[model samples]
Structures are given as structure tokens and as C-alpha cells.
Target: MGVSIVDVAAQANVSTATVSRALRGLPRVSESTRAKVLATAQSLGYVASPSASGLASGRTRTVGVLVPFLDRWYFGHVIEGMDQVLRDNGYNLLLFSLGGYRHGKMRRFTESMVRKQIDALVVLTLGLSAEELRQLHRTDIPLLSVGGPVEGCSGVYIDDGAAATAAVEHLIALGHRRIGYLRAGIQDEKNFEVPALRTIAFETALAKAGLELRPAWCMVGDFTVAEGQRAAARIFDAPGEQPTAIFSGSDEMALGLIFEAQRRGIRIPAQLSVVGIDDHEFSASAGLTTVGQKPLEHGKTAAGMLLAELGGTPHSLRETLMPFELMVRDTTAPPPR
Candidate 1:
């Protein structure tokens, strides 16, 4: 024998509607009445059924988060931040990890799978094509993005190009003229153009300083430690002048460069200064200098935006650019005379 709203209302000498509103924490119920209803419900061991409540209110109080890669540091950090914010506001998270091959998953998520599950959607580090976005828009799901720009959606993102420029500027300020860049060879199937933006920023900054943009000084590598290690070996062994500074697109790659460089007795920040983007956890532990983009903040903000829309609040549809900071550390210094 379970207590229902009727039992709570009768015990509190209140209407069933008042008991229901009090249990849901809606504003119309006075505090005194709410307390009475809560006390009655607790004494009778009455609990509100989320399934029944959802059927009545037409809201599940859940948010769906779609991320392209789960193993990467940036995506992981963002998810952690989003989880905290959503939980605090009485919303549950439904996470879907799109595999490394993101193209196929992206199409399916927007079309058949995610439409009915969540009240809102949060996408991370992924660029949905125009057509795909249009199809998602048709679902009328409140959408928010993190990590990159998305047209016709509210989002929070860091300027990847500016962050890249800041990393290069730090090395330049240290008087390292010959800088080598380790970057992704091409965009993956997610259609995210992060690598392209980094490349353009690197070249733009170098050109402004009257430095020659040498193709040889640039090496193509994926966002993996192994790829960075391989690229480091090729750069150090190539028949040309060794660069005094190395700017890696990611902290993972930068760590690989430092490891390989140390094994060969190459003194860090003396013979070679190294700088990386995304101040990941390992960056601090390794004392590696980096350009910091707050992925956690980005995720929290994106979740907040989606929640606002779900709450029937007015949410602006535009790119939200989060700021970046330069974290100076032991890895970067002036090249030796």
C-alpha cells in the first residue's frame, strides 16, 4: 500500500493540486503549505513517479549530450563540467559518444535516435553540416554547441585561431625565430575545422613578423602521442636547420615531443623551447607551458544555455566565444645564445 498525492493532500488538509505543485517545487505553493505537504508525504512514504509526472508535464528533465570523441582530454573535461551543472539543476544527462569516425554517427543522432529522449541537446567539438543542422532544427530540440562555431544555434566556444596565435606569440617573445609546428594533416569526418584554423593562425602570425612560412618547418601529425613522436623524429632527422622552438597543436603531442627530445639528450627550453595549446592536466604535472582554453567552462556554459531554452526562457542563437589565457611554465624560454 503506497501513499499517493491524495493521501498527502488529505493528511496536510490541502488540495491534491497543492500537494503536486509543492512536490514539484513549483513557485505558486506557499512555503508553509509546501512544508506541510512535504511533511505529510514523508510520513506516508509517498514518492512522485517521474514517468507519471513526465506524461502529465510533457518534460523528462533530461538533456542529451553528443560528443565526437570521448578519450580526448578536451572532450572529457567538457563533459565533466556539464555533468556537474546539469545535476545541480535537477536535470539528468544522456550521453552518446560518437566514435572517431563521426560522420555516420552524426547523421543518425540528429535523425532517428535522439529526437525523443532528451528535452535539449548539447554537441561538443563537432561541426554539423548545414543540411544536418537544418534537419536537427526541424526536431525543435533546444540545441547548444561547445568547442566550435555552429550557425543558428546557441553555443560556447574558444577561438582556436587566437589560442594558436597566442602560443606562437609566446615562443616569438622568447626570441625563437625558427619554430616548427606539429599539426593535424587533415580534418576528420566530423567536419570540424580546428586544425585548419590553427594552421591559418600560425601562418598569419609569422607573416606579420616578416618571417618566412616554410613548408619544411611544418609537419603533419594527428592528435595522438604516437603521431607526435613520429613527427618529432622526422623533424629532428631532416636535412635542414633544426628549429629552436616547437609549437604543437595539442598538449598530448607536445608531451610526446618532449619525451623523444629528452631521450636524445636535447636540452629543453635551452636548445629548444616547446609550447602547446590546451592546458590539459598533464601539462601542469609535466610543467609544460601552454595556451589555456577552459573546456570545463565551455561545457558548463553550453549546458546552461540548453537548460535555459528548455525552461522556456529566451536563448540567443549565436556563437559564444570563451576567452583564453597564456599559462607560462618551465617548457618555454629564450633559445640559447
Candidate 2:
């Protein structure tokens, strides 16, 4: 027998009506009681029907968002913007989160749910294999992307190479020739669009400026603040000389670098200059010099674009380039004389 609302209500010791309301995320349920009901339902393997939407007309009026991490600042803020738009348009968001980033996972995407569950799909900052993209295409619904490039997919993202180039140029213009870089991990290098383009621009900018590339100064990270701290330890502990400045790929990693640098009593810019991408909310207080872009706008813009297509306003543009700016602040300066 299928797990029904009656079964869930019995196990949760709540009325069947309560189970219905809680499962549908309706108001009037106490937070504690709602949580308990949700846990009980999950434990009982209860599946909710998409009966609320127009499933009969082959339209769910819900957008499916595939994200690598829901907790990360970038993804969270982007989802926030996307949610506001979707909600206002009488649509709901369906999220598929990986919980964390992992390297070399050979999981092929099966888009059967895409056909059954959503009217449109938004892929956020995660890479999709050609085969996976094909699977998604087979569903014949609109596919939109934010923050990363999926080949043959229409998307919106900042110009990564240009942004990285501007950041590197900021360091160079500040007269810091010996600049290091905190780069994305190997997995990002292999599949993701944002990190790979940024890395190329970083290297190209250094070369164009006639600066020497030092292998010892480059650090690989998963673009997290915690990983940035550990990478900093390796930087200071290396046997040879170190670069006077660093260009972190993201603001979160830069914050981590600054935290670790300050912990070791290294005076900002006086001892080490650090610049990062993304002017995260805390960037102002921390005084990080970075190339800033808005992830929120990326989300709102992409979601609106997708909805436009669904609303019979399709456009010919396959990709849109967003904007970025270099914000100079206390964390960077002219190299020590």
C-alpha cells in the first residue's frame, strides 16, 4: 500500500488535515509541530503529489533549480532573488541541492523528473555534462542558467575572464608585481565555466604585464572560506620566498585568507596585499579589495528571462554577459618599499 496522508498522520500523531497542511507548507502550523511532522513524513517515505499545479495540461508552473550547495552565500542569495520572482509570478521553486561539492562524481543526470515536475529549469553555477544536457533537452522545457556556462545552453553570467583580468590589473596597477593567486580546485578546472575562465584571465594578465609566474605561490581551493584558511597556512609555511599580493578567485576565500593572515599578525597590504572577486555582504566591513558582481541580479535576471520565454516572449540571444566592477579598499596597496 502507498504511504498516504492517513498513514503519515497516524505515525506523527497529528490530524490528517495537519499532515496535509504541513506537507503543503501552509501557514497555521506551529514551527515545532511542523518540523516534527516533516521528520515523521520523511522517515515514513511519504511522497507528495504535484496535484496543486496544472499537471493535466503538461505544465507544473514550477521552476526546478539545480544547485551544488544551498548553504553557500552565492547560491543562497541567487536563490533568494529567483524565489522572489517565481513567487510573484504565481510559480513555486523546486530545488535539487547536492548538499556539498565533490570531485569526480560520475552521476549522470536523469531528467525524467524534469518532464514530470517543472515548467522550466534553472541550473545554478553547476556544470552539466554534454550527456546530461542532452537528457535535459529531451524534456523540451526551457533551460536557463546562472553563474556558469553550459555548452549549447542559453544562460546569464558575469564575464569571468574580464572580471579576473580587472582584479589582476588592479594588483598590477597598485605596483605589486609579485602577486599570488588563490584558484579553484581541479574539479572546477575540469568542468565548471566561471573558475576556468577566471584562471585563464589571471594567468594571461600576469603574462601580459611581464610578471614572473611562481608555482609556489598558487593555491588550490574549493572556493570556501575554510579551505582558504588552510591554503594560507601552506602559503606561509613554504620554504622559499612568498608573493607580496594575492588575487583570490572569490570574496569568501579572500575573507578566509585575510582572517588567517591577520591571525599570523601579518599587517594588511603592509605585509601582504589581498584582492578577491565578489563584494560579499561582509566585504565592506572587512575592507576587501575585489572585483564585485551581483549574484542576486544574476538569479533574478535569469528567472525572469526564462519566464518570459514561457510567457510567449522568446528571444534569440543564447547568452547574456553581466557586469562587474573593481572595488579598491583597505586590503590592497602599493607593495612595501
Candidate 3:
């Protein structure tokens, strides 16, 4: 027979109730006691069944994480941080991929979520519909968002508009008057606030710097290397004067643009300059200049907030903006004379 809670409680020198509370990560359990109980449980090979525990405490000890795309670097890193935190707290994570911004998929996911047993919900980079929001609100569970702000909910994210402005300002300061913007064009227009804010900030920065917004300089890509290559080719093949510098919405696209430019016999930082958001892992090696925010930190913060709420200390439903830095690399320089 498997080791039971009684064995763990006896080993930890605590009551069965206390052992249960500690194992479930409930509040009021001292850290030392919790650690001792966990150690004892581990040593005894004791594993509490989820169904039994949920029946006793009315909590599943699980959190549901909703993401747009699991393949993206940002989402993957954020999930890693969140999963670590959840495991540390003796909780489990249930991941639900919405398969991009498809309305039908979102509806189906929301409907399915209503049947699942979860203590909290975390949404990454995707906005919820009004009906879905109402459904989740009715559950009265802690809900957290990452990478973008949601109405009437608490979230952790960087200021997309400010970051975009800073990136464009860096190019402007380097004496680049003609600048291009490469933006992600996928996702439903209504739910795409992050890119919209960045686009607005880019235009605002250009206008504030007394530079005309050239229609030919704005290109839309699918936030992929191939799309970036295509955008770069279009800019180069155009009949008019090309922009001296380009700002991509993501580092992957920026790297792709650079690779494509090199393939066409164009020199980087000598004939063209590039800037992007998201300091992707390969961005450093590729020497792509970008505005960087810590996705892992965002995940940790969101998880902390949810745990706090679960522990009966609900935070205000205000959005928290994380910090960002402008990373100067070899790809960005002053416009060629």
C-alpha cells in the first residue's frame, strides 16, 4: 500500500490536518513547517490524490494557462517561469492553446474551461471576449494576464507603446529621418492591442521628430523570418528611395530582414539599420538591436499575483507595467551619408 497522510503527519510531528494544509499550499502554514512536511512526505513516498484533496478543500490545486501560440519564444519562456512557480507552490498547470486568434477556437476553449476544475486562470498575450470574460468572472477565481492589459482584470506586462517609442527615438537620435516599420499583421484586429499600441507609438515618434510618415515605409509581416524576408525584399525592390532604417515589431523578424538583406548583397549598418522589440535568444548572437523585456519575470509576477489572491490577499484590478531596456547592438547605426 502507498504511504498515507497519517504516515507523513507522524514523520513530520504534525497533525493530519496541518499536513493536509501544508501539502495543499494553503495560507497560515509556516514555511518551516511546510518544508518539513513536504520533506517527510517525499521521504515516505506519499502522494495526495487530486480528487480526494479537491473534495476536502474545494480547490483543485491547479491553474489554467491560456496562450495564443506555444511555439513562440516569448510564450514558451513565460510558461517556463510560471510552471516553475506553480510547482514550487505544490500546484499544477493546465495549458490551453487557442490556436492563434480564432474566434471559434476561443469560444470552444472558454466553453471547455467552464467544466474544468481550476483554482485560477492566467491568459498570455490574448484578449478575452466579453462573453468569455463574463463567464470567467462568474467563477470568482483569480485571473491574471501577461504581455497585455485586460479591462477589469489585473495583469503584468511591459508598456508596448513606450518601448516602441524608445526604439524609434534611438533611430532618430542616430540621425535617421527616413524610417520603416515592420509590424505583425496576423491576429484578429479587435484583439490585437499590443501591436496596435506599438504602431501608434512608432507613428507618433516619427511625427514628433518632424519626419513625414511615408506610406511605402510601413510593411506588415506575419511575425516570422520568412515574412521579414518578404518585407525586406519589397522595401528594396520598391521604385523610390528606401528608408535608411527599419523598426520590426519582433526580433525574429528583424533577424530575418537582416539575413535577407545580406543575401541581396546589401551591407548592414552601412546601407541599412534595423531595430526590433523582444531580445530573442538569437538576437544577441545576430547582433540585432532591440528593446528587451523579461518574459520570465512577467510570468513570475503574474503567478505571484494569482497566488496572493488565492491566499485571500486580492490586489487591485490595475495593470502593472514591467520594465524594459534598449539594447544597442551592431545592427543599428547612423544613416549612411
Give the Cα-based TM-score of candidate 2 against the true structure. 0.82
Answer with 1 or 2, whichever has the higher TM-score: 2
Q: Go through the candidates in order and give the C-alpha RMSD of each one to the true structure.
A: 8.6, 11.3, 8.4
Give the least accurate 10-residue stretch of model 2, judged by summed lDDT. 50-59
Candidate 3 CA-lDDT value: 0.81
What shift in Å separates residue 133 of candidate 1 from its native position after superposition? 2.3
lDDT of 1 by residue, 98-202 (tens): 666645644444455564456677777676667667766765556777887666766788889999999999888888889899987665423676777888899
For candidate 3, report its TM-score: 0.82
Kindly report which residue stretches of model 1 are placed more than 4 angstroms away from their true locations once superposed.
Answer: 1-55, 102-108, 316-318
lDDT for model 2, on a 0 to 1 scale?
0.81
lDDT of 3 at 215: 73
* After superposition, candidate 2 runs with Cα above 4 Å error: 1-57, 99-106
